[model samples]
Target: MPDVTKAIASDIFSGRYPAGSSLPTENELGVEYGVSRTVIREALKVLAAKGLVLSRPRVGTVVCNEDDWNIIDPQVLAWHAPHALDDKLFDAILET
Candidate 1:
């Protein structure tokens, strides 16, 4: 579960699924990862609590903007930095 959460977190931070983009449904993710929807939802809850994602009714889960991200969190910044190659994102992360 932790591995899945971290992988999902890394994917979100990497912009594999950009802000405002809907992620795979819990069921889809569960099938892809060979986990249950319960585990997927719990992982997503962790991300949401970390301000890395927004889960809304009918909209699914979406990555949050930089402003919405927990930039002050070293773990979050570190997660985002290595995967983010864009100059703008790098600058933003550094600035934070």
Candidate 2:
């Protein structure tokens, strides 16, 4: 269960889903991952609690804006820190 949650979080952070995009339906995800809908639901809940996604009635789950994400959460921070530093290095190089 935790593994699924982390894997989904990693995918989200890697831009596989991108912010503001609706996630695949629970049924779709379950079929794709070979898990039950309940597992997919649990994973979605994990993301929602981290502020990376939001669940709405009828509309299902959608990724939150990057600004709304819990940027300081250890897992989230680990995922983005390297990319942020790389961006900074690129910016410095561009100024030369």
Candidate 3:
């Protein structure tokens, strides 16, 4: 479950899934990843909890703005560190 979430988060942070983009349906993701919908749902739940995605009942999962992400999440920090290039989150913390 953790691995699945990490991979998806990597895809998002790496620009494979830009903000405002809707993620594939759970069934599609399951097929794409060779997993079950249960796993995809769990992964999506993790993403939603991190504020990286918004999961609506009918709209599926949509990537949220980077500003809304949980900077404290280790995975989120790791993903941002390299992809952000400017280390914006690190700069923010240093400024604080």
Candidate 4:
């Protein structure tokens, strides 16, 4: 579950899901991660509370703007920079 959240969070911060872009539906995420819709919603809620995403009815969840991200939070930034050791996503990490 944590891995799924981390992966989704990383993708959002890396601009894979750019600001204003809608995220996959909970059902889609559940299928992708092989988890229940309830788990997907919980993971999304974590991102939402961190201000990395915004969930709206009908519109679905969307990645928030970079300026709205809690970049100063170590945990948040770290979660988005797992590949930092190899510089694989260094540029993307800096972008956030």
Q: Best by TM-score, which number?
A: 3
Pick by lDDT: which candidate is best?
Answer: 3
Which sections of candidate 2 miss by over 4 Å? 79-96
Worst 10 residues of 1 by lDDT: 84-93
Q: Give the residue spans of candidate 3 off by over 4 A.
A: none
Residue 49 of model 2 has an lDDT of 84
lDDT by residue for model 1 over 22-83, one digit each (tens)? 89999999998899999999999988878888999988898888668776566666666677
Indicate the TM-score of model 4.
0.80
* Each prediction's whole-model lDDT (CA): 0.81, 0.78, 0.86, 0.81
Clash count (model 4, backbone only): 0
Candidate 4 clash pair list: none
Can you tell me which runs of candidate 4 are displaced by over 4 Å? 83-96
Cα deviation of 18, candidate 3, in Å: 0.6
Candidate 2 residues 33-73, lDDT tens each? 88999999998887898899999999988899876877656
Please write out the lDDT profile of model 4 over residues 1-96, one tens digit for every residue.
778888899888666898999999999999989999988989998888888999999899999986686765676868866534435345445766
lDDT of 4 at 19: 93
For each candidate, give its TM-score against the true structure.
0.79, 0.77, 0.88, 0.80
Predicted candidate 2: what Cα RMSD to the true structure?
A: 5.5
Q: Which order, best to worst by TM-score?
A: 3, 4, 1, 2
